[model samples]
Target: MVRAAVVPAIGAPLEVTDIELPEPGPGQVRVRLAAAGVCHSDLSLSDGTMNVPLPAVLGHEGAGTVVAVGDGVAHVAPGDPVVLNWAPSCGSCHLCALGEVWLCVNALSGSGEVYARRADDGTDLYPGLNVAAFAEETVVPASCVLPMPAGIPLTDAAVLGCAVLTGYGAVHHSAKVRPGETMAVFGVGGVGLATLQSARIAGAERIIAVDVSPEKEELARRAGATDFLLASGTTPREIRGLTDKQGVDVAVECAGRAVSIRAAWDSTRRGGRTTVVGIGGKDQQVAFNGLELFHWGRTLSGCVFGNSNPSEDIPVLAEHVRSGRLDLDSLVTERITLEQIPEAFGNMIAGKGGRALVVF
Candidate 1:
C-alpha cells in the first residue's frame, strides 16, 4: 500500500488515501517519488476539462528514485534518480521521426490502462497522464522514466518534469525569443513564472509580467521580470505604453484563460510571436478579425508540453540549474504533504501563489 491522491471520477474532489500499487511488469519501472508538483493540468483532469480513466492518480510533475525495473528495462536501475515524463514519445511515430517528439501521437496511449487498485475497494485506477507521480510509489512504463540531469536536487527536479520544461521551451523553442528581445509572460503561475526566468536566461532586454493579482509583482520580479502589470482589459495598451508604442516582441500566455490569450496576442508587436501554453476550456473562445491577422503579421501557435523533447532538454536545464542561471527552489511557493493537494488545487483556482509541491 502506498499513499496517493486519487480522483475517483471526473468533477470529484481528490481523495488523499492509500492504494495498492502493483510491481513493475515487463517494460515497466517502479519509482519511489521524492516530490511531485500539483499542476493546473491535474485540476483540469479532476474537473473534466481533461478526461482520463476513472479513479486516476493525478500528478505528472515529479522526480524519484527507481526501485525496480522489469525485463528489457536496461536504461535505468534500482536507485537511479529519474524524472517522470508524463508524455513519452514512441520513437516510431511521425513526430518522433521529424524530431518533434513533443507532438508524438503515441505519447499518452498508456493512460487508459490500470496500474493500481483502491486499497479500500479494489477498484481499478489508471495513472493520470501515464506517470502517476502524485503517489509515493507508482509503476509505469520504462519510457516514462528519464535519467535526471546531474546536480539538481532530487526534490527540486520535479518542476523540471513539467513547469520548468514548459516555461523554458515556450521561450526558447515555441516563441524562439532572441537575445536582447523584449518578452512578456502572461500569468504568474508555475509555468508563467518559469517563462519569466527563461526569458531572462535568454537575455531578453525587457521581461514583462502580467497577472490579475497585484501581490505577484514581487514574485514576478524575483523570477526576472523587468516590469509587472495587473491584468485588465487595458493590459495590452499598458504594455505597448511601456514599450514606446511598440508591444513586446514575444508574448507567451500561461494563464489558461481566454482573456489572457487574447491579451498575449494583442500585446505582441507586428511580426512577433505569440505562444499559447495554457489549457483553456472550449467555452472560453478567443476571436480575431481577418484584418488584424493579416495586419499584424504575427504568429500564434499552441504549445503542448512546452513543445519540449524532455529527454534532450533536461540536460540543458540542469546545466542552468548548476550555474544558478535557473532557480528551481524559488519557483516553489509552498512545500506540502500529499494531503494538501486539494488545497493546492484550490489555490490554483483562486489564482494564488506559484507552484505548490508535494514532498513525499
Candidate 2:
C-alpha cells in the first residue's frame, strides 16, 4: 500500500489515505515520487475550476526515481531520477506527425482510467491529468517519464514538468520572443516567474511583471523583470507608459483571470502577440472590440504546456537550470509533506508564496 492525497469528489477536502498501486502495465513505468509541486491546476482540479472525474489523485508536476518498468519500456531504468510529463504525446498522432506534439490528440485520452485503488474498499482511483503524482507511488506511461541530469535537484526539478515548461515555452516557443523586444507578463506566480526568467534568457530589452500582491515584486524582479507594477484598472496604461506608448512586443497572461486576459490583450503593441498561458475557469469570459482583431493585427493565442515537447524541451530546460541561467531554486519558497497539502493549498489560494513542493 502507498499513501496518497485523494480527492473523493468535487468540493471535497483532500484525504490523505493509504492506497494500492498496481504494477505498471506494458509500456508503463512506476515512480516513487521524490517531490511534487503544489500547483494552481491541482487546486483547480480539487475545487472544480478545472474539470476532471472524481476520486482522483491530483498532481501533475513531479519528479521521482523509477522503481520499475513494465514490458516494452526501455527509455529509463530502475533508480533513475526523472520528471513526469502530464501531457505525453503519442508519436503517431496527426499533431505529433506535424511536429506539434504539444497538441497531441492522445493527450488526456486516459482521463478516467485507473492505476491506483482504495486500499480498504478496492474501489478504483482515477489518475488526474494522467500523471497522478500526489501519491507516494504512481504508474504512468513510459512516454510520461523523462530522465533528469545527475546535478539537477529532484525537488526543484519537479516544477520543470509544468510551471517551468509552460512559462518558458510561452516565451521561447509560443511567443518566439526575440532579443531586444519588450515583454509584459501578467501574474507573478510560478509560471509567471518562469515566463519572466525565460524572457530574460531570451534577452528581452524590457520585461514588465504585473501582479496584485506587492510582496511578489521582489521575487518578480529577481526572476528578471526590469519593472514590477501592481495589477489594477490602469495596468494596461502603466505597461504602455513603460513601452513609450508602443506597448510590449509580447504580452502574456498567466494570472488565469478574465480581467488579466483582457489586460494582456490590451497591453500588446499593434501587430504584436498575446499569449494566454493561464488555465482559467470555463465560465470566465473576456471581451474585446470586434474591429480590433483586424485593425490591431495582434495575435491572441492560447498556450498549453507552453506548446512544449517535453522529450526535447525538458533537457534544454534542465541544462538551463544547471547553468544558473534559469533560476528554479529561487522559485521554490516552501517544502512540505503530503499530509500538509490542504494547508499548502490554502497558502497558495491566499497568494502566499512562489512554488511550494510536497517533498517525499
Candidate 3:
C-alpha cells in the first residue's frame, strides 16, 4: 500500500491514507515521489471549482525517481529521476497539429481512469489531473513522466512540474514580454512569484507586483518585483501612477478572480497584452463594453499550463536555474510533509506565503 492524499468527493475534505497501487501495465510507469508542490489547482479540485473524477489522489506538481516501467515505456527507466507532467499533450490532436500543444484537447483524459484502489474498502481510485503526485508513489501513463532537467536538485524540481513552467510561459510565450518593457504581475502566490522572476529574467524595466496581502510586499520584492501594491478598488490607478500616468506595457493576472482580471486589463497600457493565468470559476464574470474593447486595442487572452510545452521548456528553465537567473528556492516558503497538504491549501486560500512544498 502506498500513502496518498485523496479527495473522496467533490467539495470533500482530503483524507491522507494508504491505497493499493497496481504494477505498471502497458505504456505506464511507476514512480516513487520525492516531493510534490501543493498548488492552488489542488484546492480547486478538492472544492469542486474544477471538475475531476471523485475519490482521486489530488496532486499534480511533483518530482520523483522511477521505480518501474511497463512495455513500450522507453523514455525513462528504473532509478532515473523524473518530474510529473500533469498535462501531457496528445500529439495527434488538432491543437497539437497546429503546434499549440499546450491546448491539446485530450490532455486530461487520463484523469477519469481508475489507477489505484482504496486499501480499506477496495473502492476504486482515480488519478487527479492525470499525474496524481500527492502520493508517496504513483502509477502514470508514460507520456506523463519526463526526465528531470539536469543539475536541478530533485526535490526542488517539483515546482517545475506546474508553477514554474506556468509562470515562465505566461511571460515568455503568452505575453512575449520584451526587455526594458514595463510588466505587472497581479498576485504573488507560487505561480505569481514565478511570473515575477520570469519578468525580471525577461528584463522588464519596471516590475510591479499586486496582491491582497500587504505582508507579501517584501516577498514579492525578493522575487523580482521593483514595486508592490496592496490590491484594492483603486489598484489600477495605483499601477498607472507608478508607470508615469500610463499603465504597464504588459499585465498578467494570477489572482483568478473577475475583479482582479478586470483590474489587470485596466492597468495595462493601450495596445498592450494582458494574460490571465489564474483559474477562476465560471460564475466569476468580467464585463467590458464594445466601445472600450474597440478603442483600447489591448489584447486579453487566457493561458493554460503556462501555454508551455514541457518537453521543450524544462531544459531552458533548468539552464536558467543553473545560471542563477531563476531562483526556484525563493519560490518555496515552507517545506511540509504529505499530511500538511490541507494546511498548505488553507494558506493558499488566505493569500499567505509562496509555494508550500510537500517533501516526501
Candidate 4:
C-alpha cells in the first residue's frame, strides 16, 4: 500500500489515503516520488475544467527514484532519479513520424487502465494525466521516465516535467522568439514565469509581464520581465505603449482565461505571433473579429507541453538548471508534504505563490 492524494470525484477535495500498488507490468516502472509540483492543470482536472475519470490520483509534474521495473524495461534501473513525462510518445505514431511527437496519437488515449486500487472499497483509481505523482509511489510506463542528472535536485527537477517544459517550449519552439524581439506574457504563474525567463534567455529585448495580482511584481521582474502591468481591459494598449506603439513581437497567454487570451492576441503587432499555452476550460471561448484575422497578419497558435519532445528536451532543461541558466529555485516559492496537497490547491486557486512543491 502507498499513500496518495486522491480526488474522489470532480469538484471534490483531494483526500490523502492509502491505495494498493500493483507491481509494474511490461514496459512499466514503479517510482517512489521524491517531489511533485502542484500545477494548475491538476486544479483543472479536479474542478472538471479538464475531464478525466473519477477517483484519480491527481498530479503530473514530478521527479522520483525508480524502485522497480518490469520486463523489457532496460533504459532505466532501480535507484535512478527520473522525471515523469506525462505525455510520452509512441514513436510509431503519425505525429511522431512527422517530428511533432508532442501530439502523439496515444498520448491521452489510455487503455482505460488502473494502476492502483482503493484500500477501503477496492475501487480502481485512474492515474491522472498518466503519471499520477500525488502519491508516494506510482507505476508508469518506463518510457514516461526521463533519467535525471545527479547534480540537479530532485525537488527542483519535479517541475521540469510540466511547467518548465511547457513554458520554455512555448517561447523557443511555438513562438520561435528571436533576439531583440519584444515579448508580452500574461500571467506570472509557474509556466508564465518560466516563459518570461525563457524569453530572457532567447534574448527578447523588452519583456512585459501582466498579472492581476500586485504581489507578483518582484518575482515577475526576477524572472526577467522588463516591465509589469496589471491585467485589465487596457492591458493591450499598455503593452503597445511599452513597445513604442508597435506592440510585442510575441505575445503569450498563460492565464487560460478568455480575456487574457484576447489580450495576448490584441497585444501582438501586425504579423507578430500569439501563443496560447494555458489549458482553459472547454466551455470558455475567446472571440475575435473575422476580418481582423486576415488584416492583422498575426499568427495565433496553441502549444501543448510546449511542443516538447520529453526525451530530448528534459536533459537540456536539466543542464540549464545546473548551469544557472534556468532559475528553478526562485520559481519554487514553497514546499510542503504530501498531506498538504489540499492547502497547496487552495494557494493555487488564490494565486498566492509561485510553484509549490510536495517534497517527500
Candidate 5:
C-alpha cells in the first residue's frame, strides 16, 4: 500500500491517508516519487479555484525514479531518475505540432488524473495535474516522465518541472524579452522570482520587482531585479519614475489578483507587451479600452505553463540548474513529508515561503 494525501473535500485541509496504489496500465509508468514541490495551483485546487476534481491527490511538480513501465513502453526502463512533467506535450495536438505544447488543447493526460482508487473498491481517483507527486508512488503516462541527467538532485529538480520552467519559459518564449530591454514583474513568489532571474539572464538593462511584501524585496534583488517596488501608495507613479515616466517595455503579471492585472496593463509602455502568467477566477474580468489596444499597438498576452514545450524546455532548464546559472538550490525554502502538505500549502497561501518540497 502506498500512502497518499487526499483532499476529500473543498475549502479544507488535506487529509493524509495510507492507500493502496495500483500498477500502471498500458502506456503508463509507475514512479516512486522522490520529492514533490507544493505549488500554489494545488492550493487553488482545494478551494475550487483551479477546477480540480475532489478526493484528489494534489501535486504537479515532482521528481522520481521509475519502478515499472507498462506494455509497449520502451523509452525509459526501471530505476530511471525522472522529472514528472505536469504539462506533457502531446505530439498530435495542434499546439504541440506548432511547438507550443504548453498550449496543447488536450488536458486529459497533461493536466488531469491518471490513477485509480482502491479503497472505494476500484473507483477512479482523479490525479491532480499530470503528475500527482504527493504519494509514495504515482502512475502516469510515459510522455509525462522525463529522464534527468546524472548528478542533479531530485529534490531540487522537483520544482524545475513547474516553477522554474514556467517562469523561464514565460520570459524566453512568451514575451521574448531581449537584453538591455526594460522588464517589470509583479508578484515576488516562486514563479515571479524565476521570471525575475530569467530577465536578468536575458540581460535586461533594468528589471523591476513589485510585491506587497518588504521581505521578498531582497530575494527578488538577488534573483536579478535591478529595482524593487513594494506596491506602496502611488505605485504606478513610482514605477513610472523608474522607467523615465514611460513605463516598462514588458510587464509580466505573476500575481493572480485583479489589481495586479490592472497594474501590469497600466505599467507597460505604450507599445510594450503585458503577459499574464498567473491563474485567476472564471468570473474575473479585466477592463480595458478597445481603442487603446489598437491605437497604441500594445499587446496583452496570457501564457499557460510558461508556453513551455516540455520535451525541449525541461532538459534545458535542468542544464541551467547544473551550470549554476538557474539557482534552483536557493529557491527551495522548506522540505517536508507528505503528511505536512497541509501546513506547507497553508504557508504558501500566506505567502511566507519561497518553495516547499514534499520529500516522499
Candidate 6:
C-alpha cells in the first residue's frame, strides 16, 4: 500500500489515505514519487474552478524514480529519475507528427483512470489530467514519464514538469521574445516568476511584472523584472508609461482572469505578441473592438504545455537548471508535507506562497 491524497468531493482539502499499489499493467510503469509541486491548476481542480471529475487524485507535476515497468516499456529502466508530464504525447497523432506534440489531442481525450483498483468493489477515481503525482506511488503510461538528468534535485525537477515548462515555453517557443525586447508579465506567482526569469534568460531588455499585490514586486524584481506594476485602477496607463508609451513588445497573461487577459492585451504595442497561458473559467469572456483587432494585427495566442516537445524541452530545461542559468530554487517559496496540501491550497487562494512543494 502507498499513501495518496484523494479529493472525494469538490471544495475540500485532499484526504491523505493509504491506497493499494499493484504491479503495472501492460505498457505502464509504477513510479515512487519523491516530490510533487503544488500547482495552481491542482488547487483549481479541487475547488471546482477547473472542470475535473470528483474522487480524483490532484497532482500533475512531480518527479520520481521508476520501480517497475510493464511489457514493452524499454525506454525507462527500473531505477531512472523521471518527471511526470501531464500532457503526454502520442507519437503518431496528427499534432505530434507536426512537431507540435504539446498539442497532442489524442493523448488528452480520456476518462483519466490511469491508476485504480481492478476489482468490482473498487471506486473509480479519476486522475486529474494524466499524471496524478499526489500519490506516493502512481501507475501511468510510459509516455507520461520523461527521464530527467540525475543531478537535478527531484523537488526542483518536479516543478519543471509544468510551471517552468509553461512559462519558459511561452517566452522562448510561443512568443519567441528576442534579446533586448521588452515584455510585461501579469501575475508573479510560480509560473509568472518563471516567465519573468525566462524573459531574462531570453535576453529580454525590460521585464515589467504586474500583480494586484504589492508584496510580490520584490521577488519579481529579483527574479528578473526590470519594473513592477501594482495594478490599481490605472494599471494600463502606468504600464504604457513603462514601455515608452508604445506598450511592450510582448505581453503575457498569466493571472487566469478575464481582466488580466484584457490588461495583457491592451498593454502590448500594435502588432506585438500577446501570449495567454492562464487557464480561466469557462464562463469568462473578454471583448475587444473588431475594428481595432483587425487594424492592430496583434498576434494573440494561447499556450498549453508551454508549446514544448516534452522529450526535448524537459532535458533542455533540466540542463539550464543544472548550469545555474535558470533559477528553479528561487521559485520555491515554501515546502509542505503530504498532509499539508489542504492548507497549501488555502495559501494559494490567498495569493501568499509562490510555489508550495510537497516533499515526499
Model 2: per-residue Cα lDDT over 1-360, one tens digit each: 999999999989999999998898899999999999989999999999988887999999999999999999998999999999999888898889999999998988776787788998987899999999998999998988999876898878999999999999999999999999999999888888899999999999999999989999999999999999998999999999999999999999987889999998999999999999988987779887879888999999999889999888988987898898998988888889988999988977777678888999
Q: With candidate 6 superimposed using the best TM-score fit, by how many Å does residue 64's alpha carbon deviate from the native?
A: 1.0
What lDDT does model 2 reach?
0.91
> Which scores better on TM-score, 1 or 5?
1
Q: How would you order the candidates by lDDT, starting with the best? A: 3, 1, 2, 4, 6, 5
Q: For every model shown, what is its TM-score relative to the native structure?
A: 0.99, 0.97, 0.99, 0.97, 0.94, 0.95
Report lDDT per candidate. 0.94, 0.91, 0.95, 0.90, 0.83, 0.85
> Which run of 10 residues does model 5 get worst, by summed lDDT?
107-116
State how far residue 233 of model 4 sits from its true place (Å): 0.8
Residue-level lDDT of model 3, residues 1-360, one tens digit each, is: 989999999877889998999999999999999999999999999989999989899999999999999999989999999999999999999899999999999999999999999999999999999999999999999999999878999999999999999999999999999999999999999999999999999999999999999989998999999999999999999999999988999999997999999999999999999999999998999999999999999999999989999999999999999999999999999999888988999999999999999999
For candidate 2, the 10 contiguous residues with the lowest summed lDDT are: 108-117
Which numbered prediction scores highest in lDDT against the true structure? 3
Clashing pairs in 1: none
Question: Per-residue alpha-carbon lDDT of model 6 for 1-360, expressed as tens digits?
Answer: 777788879876578877766698789889999889898898888878777667778798899999999999988989899998788877898878898888887765543554664133466677777777888889888888988775798767888889999999999999999999999999888899999989999999999999888889888998999999887667777888987798899999887888889888888898899999988887669999989899888999998868987778878887888888888888889888889988888877777757888888
Across residues 85-168, which tens digit of lDDT does each residue of candidate 4 receive? 898888898999999999998886542468789998899999898989999999998878988976888878898899999999
| Total backbone clashes of candidate 2, pairs 3 or more residues apart or in separate chains | 0
Task: Report the candidate with higher lDDT, 1 versus 5.
Answer: 1
Q: If candidate 3 were superposed on the true structure by all CA atoms, what would the RMSD be?
A: 0.7
TM-score between candidate 1 and the true structure = 0.99
Q: How does candidate 6 fare on TM-score?
A: 0.95
State residue 105's C-alpha deviation in candidate 3, in Å: 0.9
Task: Write the residue-wise lDDT of candidate 5 on 66-110 in tens digits.
Answer: 999999888899988899887676678776688776777775454
Cα deviation of 284, candidate 3, in Å: 0.5
Candidate 5 colliding pairs, count: 1
